[model samples]
Target: MVRLKWRYRKRLRKKYGRLIWKVKNRKGRKGFFKSTVHRYPRRNYRILVANEYIAAHLAKSLGLPVARVIQAHVRGPRGRIKRGLISMQAKGGQVIPWKKAKKKLLKKPHKYVKQAKKLARLVAFDAWILNPDRSDRNLILHKKKSGKKYKWYGIDHGISLFGNPTKWNLRRAKKKFSCKKAYKFCLHSGDKKKQRIPRGLKRFTRDNRKQLGKMVKKIQAMPKGKLKKAIRRVPKGLLTKAEKKFIQKVLLCRHKHLKKALKRVSKHFA
Candidate 1:
């Protein structure tokens, strides 16, 4: 657990939680702050903060691009919330709305063939984690320099394990988790009216399904030790022994069919 002492500026409050004022690093660099607090009965995620922390690490380990995340301390309305989590806002990138990108993207969705290949792994990653929040809105289009190609980033996993973080429990995590809802139209064709591939994954079939297969095999072959090490990144006391074990089971079960599950969906893009 890392401690970030925030130097207050202004607060951006939302329904979920508030973003801390900008923080100044040792070099006095300023950056944005996001905090996740524990909600009661209707919602609880003291453990969920840890979940996001672990998820981010796992995503990075698998070579997936994600925002920088760390566990930190921030003053909440109640008091100093130790369970708070922080993500360093990506600088100098514009969020390309799906509508605009769709024109260029779908027309030659695989134009940047390398990125298209990465998108396959990303889609498979979301499926494995069962995150349904991979909408176009979360994709960040970043251009490093003038006339350079854009770099894409997949953000937000606060709701990965369960639509509502608090909904995760021992029984649910240990059971046979289903991707039906998360992968709905993308992986399994259900309703033409309701089903569609995520904008970020529209070009998922590039490389003749190589990246998808590679990611699936990578996830399925994750050793128990590595999985545990990643999950343990959560702050102490945030997750119980039972909760950790539950999440482990969920990942293993999900990975078991991840390859075939994604292969079925890749055909749509084909």
Candidate 2:
């Protein structure tokens, strides 16, 4: 329900609806504009916005905790209006980046048993979507005041789906995708020297393995029609008919091969 403005060199020009921040380049160039916000509209911004919207819906269908996204109109610097997305901030808790939360949570596995299982499913979800940017910064940890537990949420999926957001086509979609980085944050036992696994793997326990398997099954069981319906929800002009069809085809293919793809990364969580 909030309208954002596009600022450029102290003047507004319509491109796509993403929040614009003015920052000086490393070389100290003045009036240089750069976007620190993810999923904001810009040149060829439609694809980025579409990627976030589609990913959010698809995640919800999988029963994952994701931020709700909606498209809204925003005015550019010159009073030009364009479509953009607004992600509703999560409430009932203060959200913290995974990077900070891992230190305290990882040391006490018994305290966060449920969170461990959710993290496993999140890793699998990222693999399914072919999102390689699932770094610690992208995943957030929300701690509710009522309990000592923390809930995890995934955000900033602009680079997902077709991999490279701006330069995607059916041809690129046909190429094989890897899930190595997607599982990079999964829970696992670390090497002898470290005596500890990666941050994402710290809470993983053998008990969660069955739950992870169930999550995979849930993903594979997702109906193709439902996936298409989710894609169709994206407003027109954000994506063309061919683009939508291409995404649907890619998702179907990935879902079909998800089990095999996940197998390669199973060791991380095991």
Candidate 1 runs further than 4 Å off: 1-43, 73-83, 92-102, 109-116, 172-197, 206-208, 263-270
Model 1 TM-score (2 dp): 0.71
Over the stretch 157-259, how does candidate 2's per-residue lDDT look in tens digits? 7656644444555544434323232232211111111112236552463446666677788987999888888887776777878778777766666666766
**Candidate 2, pairs of clashing residues:** 12-77, 12-78, 17-41, 18-41, 187-201, 188-201
Clashing pairs in 1: none
Quote each prediction's TM-score: 0.71, 0.68
TM-score result, candidate 2: 0.68
Deviation in angstroms for 152 in model 2? 2.2
